[model samples]
Target: MCRLLGVVTHAPTRLADTLTDLIEPFTGLSREHCDGWGVAAWQPDGELAVSKDVLPAHASPAFAATLAGSVTDAALLHLRMASPGLPTEPRNTHPFSAGALAFAHNGYFAPVEAIDELIDPDLLAGADGDTDSERYFLRVLTRLHDEDPVDALALAAADIRERAQFASLNCLLLTQDALYAYSEENPDSEVSRRRGPDFFRLRYQARAGRVVVASSGIGAQDGDGWSLLPYRQVLEIRRSDLRVSTHLVRGALVGAGG
Candidate 1:
């Protein structure tokens, strides 16, 4: 399991001011999910900037410096607690990037080999590490060139569902103009049962021209305005206007849109 935090706003904002309160406390969660941390921010000229460390967020001076130095209208942050067998290496870190897109996931699934077979060869060839999350992101990126982000995600979910079962597929996908997120879980899966119900909880708050969607820990503390995003649902927040939209991912697949 892991923690995810994302923000999209109408005005350029410093991460220190926009997310420090929420993220500072969230880092303490690394005490349990202490594998690694990664952050991705969209630059003013529409490029993606990423920083990652294999060290746990709470203890990493690099993590603290990156957060305080970053200023952007759109950003994605992840704290990873690696599943069994995966290493705590920079390549395995979250907020994986390809082109202008960045992705972070907060769950586990099986049959990684099967998932790899479904990814585009070109993308798979460039893979830096062997985490299922990175393979999943590559699969999504392949479809993104031909389909809208939402549709691409839905397709990726559908494909994964066909290949294997997943405990949860909660993820955040960041593009230059928007933030896309989703929450999905198979309640009967062994991983899900072990992690407990709240393990996959996701929520969002849209207020004061800023919108944020995150895993339970961060959103839960945002107070009165937060709303739980239903399981199997995808959320989109446009950075241009801070508009929000929601969609149900068809079938048992877990997908995202923006």
Candidate 2:
């Protein structure tokens, strides 16, 4: 499991102001999701810059330094809690990137071999780590070449669900111009019982010409402008006008609640 935070603003913004406060207590979450930390931001010239460390967010100076800097219009942050049997290394960190896309996932799926078979040989060759999250990201990236992001992710989610009976697939996908988010989990699974329901729940807030989406409302109070993104839903937030488009990729499953 992991914690994910993504932001899309109407203009260039210092992440320090927008994310500093939100990320302060987030580091505290490292008490559980303490494996590693990573951040990816779009640069002014439309390139993605990623910095990651295999140290807990609460203890890593690199994590603090990365957040103190500025990001052009979008940023993605992740705090990883390694799943059983997976090693904690920089290569296994989140916000995995390829070309202009960066991705982070907060859930786990099993039978790694099954997921690997679904990915193209070329894309699988790009994976630097063995975590299922990286494989999921690559699967989605492969779909990006032929479909829109939302639809591409939907396909990825469907494929995972079919191969793995009990899995959670909540993720945040970032491109230069927009942020795409998805939330889904199998409530009956052991993974869900161990991680707690709120761990997989994702929330978002759209205000002040900005849209912020996260795996949980760690930095935000219950009220404010935040609203829970229902399970099985996907969101597309554009930076140009801060327009948000949402679509339901799967039917709401019974017993699934945030």
Candidate 3:
């Protein structure tokens, strides 16, 4: 399991400024989910800038520095609580990057091979770490060849749900163009039962000029500005205008945010 935080704003903004008082509480989640941490931010030139470490976010000097220094219209933050067998290392860290896209996952699937068999051999060959999450990212990337980010994720996620035993499929995808969030969890999975129903839930808050989507434990309460993202759905926030659109897996846009 992991914690994900993504921000998309109409204008470039520092992460601290965007997260405000919730920043520390969010990073404090590292106390329990302390395997590693990573941040992917967009540069003014539109290039994706990524920095990560094997250290816990609460303990890593670099983590604090990156949060304080990153100034972009979009970013993704992850605090990892590695699966039982995965290692704590840079290669296995969250926010894996490929070209201009960055991805972070908060769930795991069994036998990793289930998803591996579905990915292009050439693309699977490029995997740097032995993590279901990384493979999940590659799976989505593989689908990107034929679908837009939203559709690609829906396809990738559906394939996993059908072929693998998973606890959750929630994730955050950051691109120069928009921020994408997908939420889905096996209601009867061990992790879900252990972490409670809200464990894999995702929520977002969209106000003038900015939109933020995050995993459940960010001190967000119901009836607050945050709205729950429904299951098996993808939420897209275009960076150009912070326009929000929601889509069901393999379905049409069902609603809009803010």
Error of 3 at 2 (Å): 0.4
Q: Considering only N, C-alpha and C atoms within 3 Å, which residue pairs clash in candidate 2?
A: none
Residue pairs clashing in model 1 are: none
- Those runs of model 2 whose alpha carbons end farther than 4 Å from true positions after fitting are 217-223, 250-258
Give the per-residue lDDT digits (tens) of candidate 1, residues 26-71: 8888888899999999877667899999899999999888878887
Model 2 scores a C-alpha lDDT of 0.82
Q: How high is the CA lDDT of each candidate model?
A: 0.83, 0.82, 0.88
Residue 89 displacement in candidate 3 (angstroms): 0.9
Backbone clashes in each candidate structure, one number apiece? 0, 0, 0
Among all windows of ten consecutive residues in candidate 2, which has the lowest summed lDDT? 249-258
TM-score of each: 0.93, 0.92, 0.95
Name model 3 segments beyond 4 Å from true: 251-258
lDDT of 1: 0.83
